[model samples]
Target chain A: MSLIDIQRISRLYQMGTETIHALRDVTLQIQRGEYLAIMGPSGSGKSTLMNILGCLDTPSGGKFVLNNSDVSVMDDNALSEIRNREIGFVFQSFNLLARSTALQNVELPMIYAGVPKSERHKRAMDALSAVGLADRVHHRPNELSGGQRQRVAVARALVNRPSILLADEPTGNLDSKTGVEILALFEELATKGNTIIVVTHEEEVAQHSRRIVRLRDGLVAADEILHKNGAAAPETPVFPPIHASAHAGPPPVPPGAH
Target chain B: MNLSELIENCGMALRAVATHKLRSMLTLLGVVIGVFSIIVVMTAIRVLQDSIETSLSQFGKDVLVIQRNPAISFGGPEVWEKIKRRKRLTPDLGELIREKASLVKSVGMQNGLFSGEVTSPYGKTEPSFSLLSLTPDGFPAKTLSIVSGRALNSSDEENGRLVCVIGSKTAEALFPNSSPLGETIKMDGISYLVIGVLESKGAMLDNSQDSVVIIPLSTGMNRYGRSPWGLTILVQARSQETYNDAMEEVRGILRTARKVPPGEADDFEIFTNDSLIEQFRSITFAVRVGAALISSIALITAGIGIMNIMLVSVTERTREIGIRRAIGAKKRNIMTQFITEAIFLCQVGGIVGIALGIAGGNAAAYFFNVPPVVPVDWAIIGFLVCAAVGVIFGTYPAYKAAQLDPVEALRYE
Candidate 1:
C-alpha cells in the first residue's frame, strides 16, 4: 500500500520584494518497504521536498497523506507527534547532540515519544546493535570517528521504529570508505523491511537504491528502476552485490533508458 | 505530563545545571545577595522589638505614673507649649489622689536627686547614681521585690529615719564580701543604714536599675531642701478592669488640685505600660519604614542583576532550548524551566540572607545585653519577597526563551 502520497504540493518563499518557488506542483507516491533515493543538484528543491515529506515544513498548496491521514492539515503539535511516531530523520551533519554519548543520542526520539526510561534504554540498545554500533554506545560524538557518529544518528532515527526512515545526505560528512559502511547499514535496515528514502546529490549514493527519483527545478526529472545488469531482477533485492559485474564495466544503462 | 515524569524532568534540569558548576554558582549569586539583605533587616527589627517587649514587661500591669509633663517629647510646638505651661505635680497632688480617688489602691510619690555620689566606708569606691526618694508604698507599687532584709515601713518614713535600700551594684561595691543589709553607708557625708538590698534587674540600654538608692520621700525633701521640684506619683489600680477608670479618676483629682481651667488641655502626663509600648512602637515604626525603603533599593538593584544574568543565560542556552523543543518540549515547558531556575536561585539567597540577618541582629542585641529574638515571620516574608523578585525580573527572559522558534533556535550558531 502507498505509505506517502503527495498531491500537487508547492512551497513558496518570500525574500524582500521577490517571491521564490522552492517546490512547484510536485506530486509523488511511495509504497511501504520501498527503498527510494531522491537525487538532485543544488537549488533543485530536493531538500525542500525532503523537509515536506518529514513534516518539518508545511506545503504552500497541496495535500500530504501519510498512512491515509491528511498530514498537511495537522497543527504544529499534531505534526510533531506524527514526526515523532511515524517518521525518523537523519541529517547530513550527523546532528548527534554533541554533548551526549552514543546511547543518549539514540535515546532522543524515544524520550520525545515519552517512553519509560528502562524500556527506552532497552529499545535504544537494540537500535544501536542494529546499526552495528553496540560497542561504541558510551562514546560521545567528539570522541568517535565520523562514521560512528553517523551510525549513532541512524540508531536514533530507528529507535522508535517509525514507518519511514528519511536520510538527507546521511554520509555526506564522512570519507568514501566510511560512507560505504553507512550505506551498507542502510541496505541492511532495508533488508529488514523498513522503508528508506535518501536525499542526496551524489549519484554513487543514489545508485545504492533500487529506484532513483531525480529532481530538477522543483519537479521530478526522472523516475526509473535501477538495473544491475542488462536483464531485470525479479524483485528489489536488499544488499545488491557490491562486486557485481555492473560495477566492473560501464554502468548498466538504467531501466527505461530511452 | 504525569507528576513522576515532571519530577524526573526537574531532576534532569538540576543535573544539567550541576554539570556547569561555574555558571550555576554565578547565577545563584544574585539570589543569595537579595535574600541576605531582607533577612538581615527583618532579624534586627525582631530582636529590637523582643528586647523592648521584655523591658516594657518590667513596668507591671495596670501601674500608671502621673508626672507634671510628658516623659518623652518630640520637640514640636505642642511639646514646647506643654513644657512651658505644665506646673510641677507636688506632694499635695499625690496626697489628694491617694485620699480622694475611689479606684486608687495606693499612691507612692517619688522625686529624683540626680548626680548623687555615694562613697563606701573603706574610701575605695565612689560611683555616681540617681538617688530616688520614695513613700512607704513605692516599692510595692513599682513591683520592686525586696531581695534581702525588709523594705521601709510607715514608722521609718514618719520618724524620718536614715534607713535606705541599696541596689545590687551599690551593695556589692560598699560591702564587698559581707552582707550590705544593716551596714551603714555614707552618702555625701551623711550616714544611712541599709535596710534592704534590691535584686539585680540587669542593665537596660540606657538605664541601670542596679545603680540607684532608694530613701523615704520626706527624708529626701528635708535633706535636699525642695527646690520647686516635680513629683512622680505611682498609682496602682484595684484591678485591670478598673485601671482605665482609676487613671481617669486620678486625672480628675490632679486637674482639680492643679486648678486647671475648663476647655484646656491637662498639664500632667499619665503614662501606663501600654502607652509606653505605643510610644516605642511609633518610633520603631518610623525606623522600620526607613529600613524597608533602604533595603528595597538594594533588592531592586539585585533584581536588576538577576534580570541581566538571566537574559545572558537565555542567550547562552539557545541551543539547549532548541534541542529540548525538538524533543517535544512545549513553550510552557521552556518557560517553566527558566522561571523555576530563577525562583530556585532567589529562594536559596533568601534563606542565606535570613540566617545572616538573624545572626547580625542577635549579635547587636547581645552586645547591648538585651535578649535576642528570631523573626520567623520576617524570614518567611524575606523568602516570599525574593520569590516575588524572581518572578518579576525573570519574566522577560523566560518569555524571550519561550518565544524562540524551534527551527530558528536549532539553526542558531
Candidate 2:
C-alpha cells in the first residue's frame, strides 16, 4: 500500500457568510521514499492539500489512509498523535523555539512523542549531526546564521523518523545560494530512501525534486516525474553541500550546473 | 501526562516566564500583595495564639477565676456597660464559696496592685514587676509552687505579717549574690522580709511570669481600700471529674452571697484558661475576616491581571503556537504549556509574598517578645491558592490559543 492515500479530498472554510472551498475533490497518492514537490500560486489550494497531508486538519470529505491507518475519521487527539508520529514539518521560517538550544529544538517532536530524556538527547544529537550541526548543538536559534537556523529546524522536523518529511517554502527566507544548498540537502535526504515532500511556488526549488504535483484552482493541474539521470540529478549538485558551521564568515561559491 | 513530560512542560513554562521578567512581575503584583496581606495577618494571629497558650497554661483545666470583667473587652461600649453595672467580687465571696460548695477544692482571693519597683540592700529592679496579695490557698489555686524557703501560712494572713513571697526572677534581680530568704525587700519604701520564692515559668509575651511579688491578702486589704478596686476569686476543683460541678456550685454560692434573683444574669464574669483562648479567638476574628476580604479582592484583581497578560501573550505568540501545533503538539499540550506558564508566574509571586509576610509578621512577634513562628499551614495554603488563581484565570487564553486554526496562526503576522 502507498504510504499516503487521499481520494476526493475536500476542505471548506466559512468566512462571514460565504463558504470558501479551499480544496474540492482532490485525489493523490504518495509511495514511500518518493521525493515530490507540490507547486501552485496563492489561492491555488496547495496549502490546503498540504494541511490535509500533514494531518494538521481533517478533510471535510475524503477517504484518507496514512501508514494503513484511516486518518479521515480520526478525532483531534488522534490526528495530533498521527502528526507527532507520522509527519515531520519544515516551514519557510526556521520556526525554532527561540529560547532552546539547537539540540533542544530538534528534540521537540520526540518530546511530544513522549520519548525518554536520555534517548531523546541521543537522537537529537544524531539528528543535529546529520544536518552537519554537531558542533553547534548548544547554540540557540538567534545565535546561529540563517542557514544554520534552517538546518536546526530541518533536524527538528526529521528527528522523529516520521513517514514523510514535509516542507512548506523551506528556503523562502534564504539567499538563492543558501536556498540551493538546502535543496541539495533535501536531495541527499530523499536519496537515502526518506519520503520527502516540498511545497513551493518557485520552479527552481521544484525542479530539484524528482516528481512535481502542480495544483491550480483546488485541483491537480499536472503530475509529472522528471528523469533523475537526465535533469533532476546533475553531474554536480546545482548547489554543493554547504555546512554553515564549516564556513561561518562567508560561504564558498559553488560551480553552477544545470 | 507523565512526570517527565510534566517536568519538561514546567521547564518550558519557566523559561517563557523568565523571557519576559518585567511583564511577569508586573502581572503578579496583585497576587503578591494579596497573599502577603493574608499571610502576614495569619502569621501574627498564630503568634498571638501561641503566646496566650503558653501563658494561660499556668492555670490548669480545673482552675477557674471570678472577676468583674471578661478576660478581654470583646464588643462596643454596650458590653462594657453591662460588665461595669454588675456586682463586684470580693474576698468574702471566696470565703462563702469555700464554706458552701461541696465540689470546691480550695478558694483563694487575690488583690493585684499596680506594678512597682522593688529594692533590696544589694540592688533595685525596673518598675515592671507585678505585685499581688494572695490568701493561703491562692498558691494551690494558681498552681504556684515554692522553690525555696516556705509558703505563707494562715498566720501570715491572720496576723497580717509584713512577710512577702517573691518570684525567682525577682529574687535574682533583688539579691544577686546572697539568698533572698530572711532578706528585707522594699516596695514603694515599705520594707517586707522575703519569706518564700516561687518557681520560675516560661516567659509569656514580653515579661517573664516569674517577675511577681506577693504579700498576705489581709495585709493588702488593710493597705489598699478593698472594695473600690474589687478582688478576683480563684477556685480549684477537687478533681477533673468535679470541675464542671465545682464551677456550678461556685456560681450558686456567689449568687446567694450577692442575693442575685432567679433567672437573672449573674453579676460576675467566670473564666478559665480555655475561656481565655476563646476570648482571644473572638478578639482576632474581626481582624482575620477583614484581612481575608481585602486579600481576596486583591487576588481577584490579580487573577484578572493574569488573564489580561495571558491573553496578550497568546495573541503575541500566535505564530509560535502554530509552529508548535505543526510540530505535533496537541491542543491539550498547548493548553498545558500556557497554563503552566501562568501558574509559574503566580507561584513566583506567592513564594516572594510568603517570605515577606513571614518576615513582616515575625517583626510584630519580636516586639511582643514571642518566639518566631513559621506558619507552615499558611504558606502551603498560599502556594495552593496561587495555583488555583493561576488555573482559574489561565484557562480562557490557553483555550483560545489551542483553538486557533494552525493555518491561520502560522500565517498570522
Candidate 3:
C-alpha cells in the first residue's frame, strides 16, 4: 500500500465576493522511499497542494488516506496530531525562530509532540548532526549563513522522525550552490526509507528527484520519471570552491547504501 | 495537557515576551495605571477612615451626652427649623436621671459661661480664656483627671462656692512656675479660688482643652446667670455591658422630667460613641461613592487600552502562532499563551502600583501625625481587579489568535 493516497481531492477558497478554486479533482499516490518533485509556476496551486499533503489544510472535497487511515474527515486536532507524528514540513524561508538558537529551533517540533526536555535535547542534537549543522547548534538564524539556516530547518523537520518529509520551495531563497547542497540532503533522507515530496518551479532544483509532477491551473499537467541514480542533471555545473566551504563537506551518502 | 507540559508552554510564552522588551513594557503601562488609580484612592480613603476612628476612640467607651440638639445635623433648613422649635434639656432632667436611673453610674450637668479677660497676680490676659461651670460629678463624667490640687466636692456646688479648677493653659498664664493651688483669679470682675489644675489634654476637633476654667455649677448659674439653657448633662454607663440599659433608662427619665406625653417624640437629643461613629460613616459613604465612581472611569479607559494593545500583539505574532500550530500546538495552547502574557503584564503593574500607593498614603498620614497604615485588603483587591482586567480585556485578542488558520498564518508577513 502507498504511504499517501489521494482520491478526487478538491480545494476551494472564497475571496471577498469571488470563488477561487485552489485545487480541482486531484488524485495521486506516493509510496515509501519515493523522492518526488512537484513543479509549477506562481499561482499554479502547487503550494496549496503541498499544504494539503502536509495536513496543514483540508480539501473542500476528497478522500485522503495517510498511513492507511482515512484523514479526509478528520477534525483539526486529529490533523495536528498526524502533522506532528506523521508529516514534517520545510518552508522556503527556513522558518527558524529568530530569537532562538539553532538547537532550540530544531527542538520545537519535539516540544509540541510533548517530548521530555532531556530526550528532546538529545534527539535535536542528533538531527542537527545528520544535517551537518551540529557545530553551529548554538548560533541563531541571523548568525548563520543561508545554507546553515536551511540545514537547521531540515533538522527541525526530521527531529520527530516523521513518516514523510515535505519541502515547499525549500531552496527558493538559496543560491544555486546552496540549493544543490540542500537537494543532496533530501536525496540522502529519501534513501533512508522516508518518503520525500519537494515543490518548486525551477527545473534544475527538480532534476535532483527521481520523479517530477508538474501542476498547472489547479490540476496536474504532467508526471514523468526524471532520474534513477538520485544525481543532479548534467546541465547543472558543480558548485564553486567558495560556496562549497559554507557546506560542512561533500554531500551525505544515503543511509544503508555503500 | 499535563501540568508539566502546560508549565513548559507558559515558559515559552514568557520567553517570547522577554525577547521583545520594549513591546512588553509598553503593553504593561495600561495595567499599571489602572491598578495605581484604584490603589492610591483606596489608600487615601483608608487613611481618612483610620484617622476618624482614632479621633472617636479618644472620647472613651460607654460614655453618653444628653443635650437639646443632636451633635451633627444632616438635613438643611427643615431639620434646623425643627431643632429650633424643640425645648431645651434642663438640669432637672439630669438630676432625675442621676437619682432614678438604675443603669446610670454617674451623671453631671455643665453650664458654660463667663468668656472674658482673666487677670492673675502675675499678669493680665485679655479674652485669652473661657470659664466653665460643672456639678461635682461632672469631673469624673467628662473623664477629667486633676494633675494637682483638689477637685470640687459636693459642698462646693451645694453652697454655691466661689472655688474653681483651672485648665493647664490658664494655670500657666496666671501662676507660671508658682503653684496654682490657693491662688485667686478674676473672671468677669469676680474673684475665685483655684482649687485644682487639670492635666493637659491635647486639642479635640481643633479646640484647645487647656484654655478654660472650671467653676461650681451653682456659682455659674447665679453669678454668670443662665443663658437660655441651664447646662448640658453628661452620663456615664457602669460598663460596656450595661451601656444600652443605661441609655434606655436615661431616655425614660429625661422624657418624664420634661413632661412629654406618651407616644410623643422626646424633645432632647442623646449622643453616644456609636451615634457619633454612625454620623461620620454616613458622610464618608458619600465621599467613597464619589471617589469610586471617578476612579472607575480611569480604570475602564485603561482596560480598553490593554485590549487595543493586545490585539496589536496578536497581529504582529501571527506567523509565530502559525509555526507553533503546525508543530502540534492546540488552539487552547495558543489562547493560554496570550492570556498568560496579558495577565502577567497586569500583575507586574499591580505590584508596582501597590508599592507606590503605600508610600504615597504613608507620606500623607505622616503629615497628619498618625502612624502609617497599609490597606492590605485594598492591596489584595487591587491585584484581583488587575487580573480581572487582564481576563476581560484579553479575551477577544486571545480568541482571535486561537482562530487563526495555520496555512494563512504561515503566509502572513
Candidate 4:
C-alpha cells in the first residue's frame, strides 16, 4: 500500500457567511521513499493540502489513508498521534523551543510518544549527530545561527523515525548558500531512501526532489516524475522502496547506481 | 504523567519563570502578602491561645471556684448589676460545701486585696503585689509549688498567725541578698514572718505572676475586712471523671446555704478551669473566623492578579504554543505547561510567606508575653491554598492557550 493516499479531498473555510474552498476534489498517492515537492502560489491550496497531509488539520471531505489508517475523519488527539508516529514537519522558520537545548527540542516528539527518558536521550543524540549538529546539542535556539537553528529543527523532525519527512519552505529564511546546503542535506536523506515531501514556491528548491506535484485553484494542476538515470528507471517510478531507516531498513539503493 | 515527565515540565516551568524575573516576582509578591496575612494572624492566635490554656491549667482542671460573679460574662453591665445584687459567697460557704457535698474532695476559702506593698529591713517593693489569703487547700488547687520553706499549715489559719508565703518576685524584693524564709516583712502596718517563697511563674497577659503574697484566710479577714470583697470558695473534685458530679453537689449546697428557693437560679456563680478555657476559646474562635475572612479577600485579589498575568503570558507565548503543538504536543501538554508555571510561582510565594509570617507572628507573641509557636498545620494549609489558588486562576488562561489553532498561532506576529 502507498504510504499516503488522498482521494478527492476537500477543505472549506467559512469567513463571515462566505464559503472558501481551499481544496476541492484533489487526489494524490505517495509511495514510501519518494522525494516529492508540492509547488503553488498563495491561495493555490498547497498550504491547505500540506496541513491535511501533515495531520495538523483534518479534511472537510474525502478519504486520506496514511499507512492504512483513515485520517480524514480523525479528531485532534488522534491526528496528533498520527503526526507523532508517521509524519515529521519542518516549518519555514525553525520552530524550536526557545528555552530548551537542541537535544531537548529534538526529543519533544518522543516525549509525547511516551518514549523512556534514557532511550529518548540516546535517539535525540543520534538525530542531532545525523544532522551534523552533535557539537551544538547543548546550545539553545538563540545561541545557534540561522542555518544551525534550521538544522536543529530538522534533527527534531527526524528523531521520531517517521515515514514521511515533510518540510514547508524549510530554507525560506536562509541565504542562498545555506539554502543549497539544506537542500543537499535533504537530497542526501532522500538518496538514503527516506521519504521526503517539500512544499516550496521556489523552483530551485523543488529541483532537488525526483517528483513534482503542482496545485492551482484548489486542484492538482500537474504531476510529473523526472528521471535521474536517463531512460533506465523510467521517467516515472510506479513504485518506491518502503523501508527508509538508516540502520534497519532496506539496503541503501545498491551502493553506487550512477 | 510519570515522574520523568513531571520533572521535564518542572524544568520548563522554572526556565520560563527565570526568564521573566521581574514579572514573576511581582506576581509572587501578591501571593506572598496574601499568605503572610493569614499565617501571621493564625500563628499569633495559636500562641496566645496556648498561653491562656497553660495559665488556666494552673487552676487544676478538676477544681471549681464559687464566686459572686462569673469568671467570663457576655451580658454586659446590666447583667453585672444583677449578679452584684445577688448574695455574695462568704467564707462560711466553703465550710458548708465541705461538710455537705459528698463529691467534693476538699473545700477552701480565698480572698484578695487588689494591690499592696511589702517592706523588709533592707528593702521595700512598690505597691504592685496582689495580696491573697487562703486556707491550706488553696495551695494545691492553685498548683503553687514552693521553692523553699513550707506552705501554711492548719494551725496558721486557725490561730490567725502572722505568717505568709511570698512569690518569687516578692522574695527577691524583700530579701535581695538572702532568703526570705523566716524573715519578717511589713504590709499594711502589720508584721508577718515569711514561711515560704513560691517558684518563678514568668508572666501572663502583661502581668508578672511572681509578684504575689499569700497569707492565711483568718489573718486576711481580720486585717482587711470582707465588706467590699467577699470570700471565694474553692472546691476540688475527686477525679476528672466525677467533675460534673462534684460541680452539681457544690451547686446544690451553695443554693441551700444562700436560701435560694427551688426552680430559681443560684445566687452565686460556679466556674471550673474547663469553663474558663471554653469561654476563651469561643471568643478567640470568632477572631479566627474574622482573620480567615479578611485573609481570603487578600487571596482572592492575588488570585485575580495571577489570572491576569497568566492571560498575558498566554498571549505573549502564542507562537511558542503553536510550535509546541506542531512538534507533537497535545492540548493536555500545553495545558500542563501553563498550569505548572502558575503552580511553581505560587509555591515559591507560599514558602516565603510562611517564613515571614512565622517570624512576624512570633514577634507579636513575644509582646503578648506568650511563648512562640510554630504552626505546622497552618504552614501546610498555606501550601495547599497556594496550589488551589494556582489551579483556580490558571485554568482559564491555560485552556485558552490549548484551544488556539496551531496554524494561526504560528502565523501570529
Superposed by TM-score, candidate 1 places the C-alpha of residue B48 at a distance from the truth, in angstroms, of 2.8
Using DockQ as the measure, name the better of candidate 3 and candidate 4: 4
Clashing pairs in 3: none
Cα lDDT, model 4, residue B44: 88
lDDT of 1: 0.76
Candidate 2 residue lDDT tens string, A1-258: 778877778899888999877776677777888888999888878888999899887899878999999999998889888888889998888888888899888888888898999999999999999999999999999999889998998899889999999999999999988888899889889888888999999999998888788776566767777776733432222221222223232232232210
**Alpha-carbon interface RMSD for all candidates, in angstroms:** 2.9, 1.2, 1.7, 1.2
Identify the CAPRI category of the predicted complex in candidate 4: acceptable
Candidate 3 on B1-413: residue-level lDDT in tens? 65545665566667766877787677666666666666776677677666766654534477787788776666799878887888876666777888898888888888778677788899665595888888878887777789999888899998999999988888888887799899899988889999999987765432346778889888888886555363678898999999988888888887777787999887878878778778867876776676567556756776787788789889989998888788777787788778877777677777887888778767767777666788899889888888887788888899999999999999999
After superposing candidate 2, which stretches have Cα over 4 Å from the reference?
Answer: A16-19, A230-258, B204-207, B228-230
Evaluation by TM-score, superior candidate among 2 and 4: 2
Give one digit per residue, the lDDT tens place, for model 4 in A235-255. 236632221221242232321
RMSD (Å) per prediction? 7.3, 7.6, 9.6, 7.2
Which 10 residues in a row give candidate 4 chain A its minimum summed lDDT?
Answer: A241-250
Query: Who is ahead in lDDT, 1 or 3?
Result: 3
Candidate topping TM-score: 2
Indicate the worst ten consecutive residues by lDDT in candidate 3 chain B.
B202-211
Q: What is candidate 3's lDDT per residue for A135-209, written digit by digit as tens?
A: 999999999999999999889888898888999889989998998999888988876767789999889888888
Off by over 4 Å in 3: A14-21, A99-111, A115-140, A191-193, A221-258, B1-33, B58-96, B107-242, B254-275
User: What does the lDDT come to for candidate 3?
Assistant: 0.79
Error of 1 at B115 (Å): 9.0
Going through the candidates in the order shown, the clash numbers are: 3, 0, 0, 0
Q: lDDT per residue, candidate 1, B1-413, as tens digits?
A: 54434554455446555666687666656556655656666667667666666655655687888877775556789778757777777787778888899998988877886556776764334556767788988887766777999887788888778989988877877788888877787776677888998877765542456777888888888798764376888888999999999988988887788888888888778989789778767866776776777677767777787788779878977876766665555666678778776666666667777787788778868866776778878878888888898788878898999889765676667
Best of the candidates, DockQ: 2
Q: TM-score, each model?
A: 0.74, 0.91, 0.72, 0.85
Query: What count of clashes does model 2 give?
Result: 0
